[model samples]
Target: MDRRTLWSNGAVAHISLQDEVTAERFTDGEVRRVTYPPLASLCKSPMGNRDREILWGQSFNVLETDKGWAFGYALRDGYAGYIEAQMLAPVEAQATHRITVRQTMALSVPDLKATKAEHVALSLGSEVCVTDTDDKWATVMGAPHTLYIPASHLTPLNDKEADPVAVAERLLGTPYVWGGNSAFGIDCSGLVQIACHACGIACPGDSDQQMAQLGETLDPGTPLQRGDLLFWKGHVGWVSDPDTLLHANAHSMSVVHEPLQAAIQRIAAQGDPVLRYARLTRL
Candidate 1:
């Protein structure tokens, strides 16, 4: 669920995490809106583990502040973390559309030739609203200005794909990251989190938390099937089929398709033994 390239200096970094910032530092009320498109990752600490993702139009409740960093809980999942104050808008904007594709760029203009750092890639399930549109491009309301994304990349929020594993499969070659949850980079739990979110299923932002909260555990002897989840001490993978596993992992440094038993043996050799397998509570 997480990221930004900003943090301020020693004026606040010198202060202890135990102390609170002056209440005056907070914007009115405590609620802030995300202005950064693509994704705003909520981290474990400032520049810490990117545990969850918030799209361009999501909101968060500010609990405290430290210089340019705001500590808060995401309104979407109530997961708490520090986000760069610059990444959020003091004013709120409602989201009406959701990005349904694996990756789509938000362009300053509708033209493909105008691509630059200004147009970063937005990941699946990130929400935005269409303010205006022509036949080929839809204008998405962005932080400082309205940006255009291809009309093909979005769907009305009410229209969602039904298969979670199929959505995960779309990210087959994304690079593995320790805590990233965007198409720009991702982690083991982040992969499942985005996959479940696309199908309108609520999922937690971490592996162990997902294991505890998501679904019913299967008996040790139960047969593996597509959509079954396998877990280790701090990692997870999805069953692509009865015999194959799909996951974003450091071992491959990317999402990969591998034999289920081979993965179990490989991880066991690395000292993290397979802990369990489970299924969606609805499945």
Candidate 2:
């Protein structure tokens, strides 16, 4: 199968597709979950930057495994890559809380200073299930182990932010990563995904999928407002105001705000024209 023909292979995932595409390959895969907070799905077995990050609780459809690399699709967005075999859980786990802020560490205990070396860094939108709790900390089930994170650092999925644009503004200087979705690093679509999901909105993990999943298309001449989604061929961003556009882009190599018209002309000059504009619908 050509990489383009592989339905689940996202741009940042492994480039090749199986020569012989068959239904049996995908159908035979078993359900698994990402136990690691930021487990990477590398294009190669050992690991490299050409990899996609798999968030905790993201579903995996593992078709095959060898030499510690499990090959399959990330069911959340159908992006196929190779996640380390050890990064998966034996059974699917329920995720109850989402990390709200940019990035935080899940420590071995509640104390941040004393347990400085005993924490796992988790990015925004990473999920966890509260297993035990106290006033200052909550013991959550983390990848391959239990972790204690600040109780205030997490919120229920339904405890949404009021302004999606405000949520996107939280990461103004975050570095851009091709397939990244966390505040530590992000991409155009990743920024949109985090911002929308924080507001209790269900947005897909990629720009094209997001365009289809978002609300009714608006005419290009329609007045832009906060939360309006601006889409290009492989990019997406949100309107922070009538004139300001917020996005995690490669040109700046970080999330930034720029004039919407400037972005349109700059992108069009590169041949990736703005495909459409969408207004988010609360469902």
- The segments of candidate 2 whose C-alpha lies over 4 angstroms from its true place after superposition are 1-28, 42-51, 115-117
- Give per-residue CA lDDT, model 2, range 1-283, as digits (tens): 4331254332222223334333333344666877765655545333644445667666677767767877777665566667788888765457778888777788876677883547788877787888888898888887656788888888976688888888888889999989877777889988887788788776666787788778879985899888888888889998888888999999999999999889889999999988888888762
TM-score of each: 0.84, 0.82
**lDDT at residue 221 of model 1 (Cα atoms):** 87
For model 2 the TM-score comes to 0.82
Candidate 1 regions exceeding 4 Å error are 1-29, 47-53, 113-118
Cα shift from native, residue 257, model 2 (Å): 1.4
lDDT of each: 0.77, 0.75
